[model samples]
Structure formats: C-alpha cells, structure tokens
Target: MRARDVRAILFCAVTTLILLIGSYVLLQSALISLALAAGWLAWLLTRPRMQRVIRRLRGEPDWNGYFRND
Candidate 1:
C-alpha cells in the first residue's frame, strides 16, 4: 500500500475514535453513542456522492454509463 493510503486509513481511524470518545463523553451512554455513530455512517454512505463512489468501487455503471470491473 502507498503512504497516502496508509495516512488516509490512519486519519479515518483516529477520527472515528475521536468521534466515539467525544460522543460517549457528551452523551454518557455507550449504546447511544454507538447508535449515533451508526446513524452518521449510514447518512454518509447514502449520500449521492458517496453512492457514486461506492458504485464505482463495486464496478457498477457510473453516471456517464462507464462500466467498471471493480
């Protein structure tokens, strides 16, 4: 893997840890924090731009009708 990919993964992991820790600290409940995180992730994944990215990753036809092999 490239250094860029490694950095991106680490960034995402740290951000997620911070979010979980912050959420727990503010909300005072593990379950609620987890739920909030799950909801947030769902919202992100369902966004149009993310959907396009996901489709591209899954080898689906893109917006311009270009087929990817994944």
Candidate 2:
C-alpha cells in the first residue's frame, strides 16, 4: 500500500531473482538455486535492521521500550 512497502517488496524480488539466476547459472541445479536463495533470504531477515523492521510492521513493541519497562 505504501511506497516504502512497495520498495521493500521490489528489493526482495530483485534480490531473490538475482540469487536464483546466479546460483542456477553457476551450479545448474534448480533445487540448489532455490535453496541458496532461501538461505540468503533467511540470513538477511535475521539481521538486526530487518528484525526491527519486521517487529515494527507487526505492531510489536520495541526492545528499548520493553527493557525500560522492566
């Protein structure tokens, strides 16, 4: 709906596309290409910035706020 959301989606699409094509070209295996793309995405999502963005998108409380409350 939002521009930021659209940009994020586009980024993910492009990243996955590049990874899939690159891995497939290099290794010539569909399954391995998919696996590598998934692995790459999983790694990216685990990053602190991505985690915070995901939490915020889910309407969850921030780590700083939670810590200050305790």
Candidate 3:
C-alpha cells in the first residue's frame, strides 16, 4: 500500500485500540463507549477530506446534499 494509505490504516487501528481499551477500563459502560464513538465520528465528520471521501465511497451526489456541491 501507499504510505498515505498505510498511515491512515495505522491511525484508525490505533484509535480503535485506544477506544476499546478505554471502554474496558471503564467497566464496559455502554454510555461511555457510545459517547466516545459518537465523538470520534463527529470529529471525523468535521474533517473536509474525510467527508469528501465518505461521500465519494457512498456514491453521494454532493457533500452538502441540500446546499452547494463540494
């Protein structure tokens, strides 16, 4: 894989591992896990490049469906 792809994969793997460890240390509280997951998702969503990639992979017509095209 390309360096960028490898880096992205490493980042995602590390983040997932960290979240899993955090959840375990928190005694498997659903609320805490859900909150962490939601926050991570929100952070990803706010990144312009990630949103564009998601829309592209999902075959979305535009990044902002109700507004202007990306």
Candidate 4:
C-alpha cells in the first residue's frame, strides 16, 4: 500500500483509540461520548477539504475542483 494510505489508516486508528480513551476517562457516559462525537463531526464538517468531499459524495459539482476529479 502507498505511504499516504498507511498514514491515513494510522491516523484513523489513533483517533479512534483516543476517542475510546476519552470515553473511558469520562466514566463511559453515553451522553458525553455522544457530545464528543458530535463535536468532532462539527469540526470536520467545517474543514474545507471535508466540505468538498461531502459535496462530491452528494453528487454536487465543485467548480474549482477542490477535490481532484481523478
């Protein structure tokens, strides 16, 4: 696999592990976990690259090609 792919996988795995640890630290409260997850989602949604990906997923065309057509 490509180095970029490997880095992405590692980032995801580490993020998940950190979230799990955060929940554990919060005494496994479902409400807290949900809030944390929602916060993360909100943060990601605000990112330019992520916005382009979301738009692409919804089949909306981006004029600037923020996300490469390739």
Candidate 5:
C-alpha cells in the first residue's frame, strides 16, 4: 500500500476513535456516536484522495480502458 493510503486509513481510524470516545465517554450517547461516525465516513468518501485509496485497496486497475472516451 502507498504511504498516502496508509495515512488515510490511520487518519480515519484515529478520527473515529476520538469521536467514539467523545460521544460515549464524554457525551454519554451511543446513537450520536454512530451518527457522527457515519457522517465522518460519508465526508471521507467524498474526498478524491480517499476514493483513490479505496479503489486501490479494492484491487482496481488505475488505467482502466473505461477512462478513455471513444
């Protein structure tokens, strides 16, 4: 895996952990934690860099013929 992909995964993991702690330990709610985590994941998925990492992890080729216009 590329450094960027590793970094992205780490970032996601850390952010989710913090959010979970804040939601349950601090705020005392599991529902809010779930919503916040889902929101964060949705936002992350919208990022182009994250999308590239996800595609790479899925073993998709970077230079597929679908990218070219006929």
Candidate 6:
C-alpha cells in the first residue's frame, strides 16, 4: 500500500480505537457519544493550520491586498 493510504488507515484505526475505548470506559449513553463526536469535530475545525488553508483557498484579501486597495 502507498504511504498515504497506510497513514490514513492508521489514523482511522487509532481514532476508532479511541472512540471505542472512551465510550466503553466513560459513558455508554448515546448522548455522550454524540457529544464527544461533536467536540472532536469542533476541535478539528478550530485548528490554526486548517484556518489558514481555508482562508487562502477562499481568496480572502490579506495585508498586501489591503495596501493595494488603499
């Protein structure tokens, strides 16, 4: 398998393991699982690198663009 594919599989396995363990050891309620999933998603969304890549892709004007606009 390719390196990227291997990495992806490993990541997925680890994530699944973590979620399973958390659910089993902490609380078995559906609400708790849903909350954990939502919290994980929110943490991923607020990451700094993700924000930078998203802003660049959206073509938001930066410092250089601001100076040119003046």
- Over the stretch 6-55, how does candidate 4's per-residue lDDT look in tens digits? 55446545775688578868777867776776676667567675555556
Output the TM-score of candidate 6. Answer: 0.42
* Model 3 segments more than 4 A misplaced: 1-14, 26-28, 60-70
Q: After best superposition, candidate 3 residue 18: deviation in angstroms?
A: 2.5
Per residue, candidate 1 scores C-alpha lDDT tens digits across 1-70 of: 3354355446555766787899999989999888877876777667665566556557766557533344
Better of 4 and 5 by TM-score: 5
lDDT of each: 0.66, 0.77, 0.64, 0.63, 0.82, 0.58
TM-score of each: 0.61, 0.67, 0.50, 0.59, 0.79, 0.42
Best-to-worst ranking by lDDT: 5, 2, 1, 3, 4, 6
Q: What's the lDDT for candidate 6?
A: 0.58
- CA lDDT for candidate 5: 0.82
Q: Write the per-residue lDDT of candidate 6 for residues 1-70, one digit (tens) a residue.
A: 2354355446545775588568857886767776776776567547654454445557764544421322
Q: For candidate 5, what is the total of clashing residue pairs? A: 0
The number of the candidate with the highest lDDT is 5
**Candidates 2 and 3, the one with greater lDDT:** 2
- TM-score attained by model 5: 0.79
For 1-70, candidate 2 gives per-residue lDDT tens digits of 3355456667777999999999999999999999999998998878765666677678877757532422
* Global local distance difference test of model 2: 0.77
Clash count per candidate: 0, 0, 0, 0, 0, 0
> Which candidate should be chosen as best, given TM-score against the real structure?
5
Backbone clash pairs for candidate 4 read none
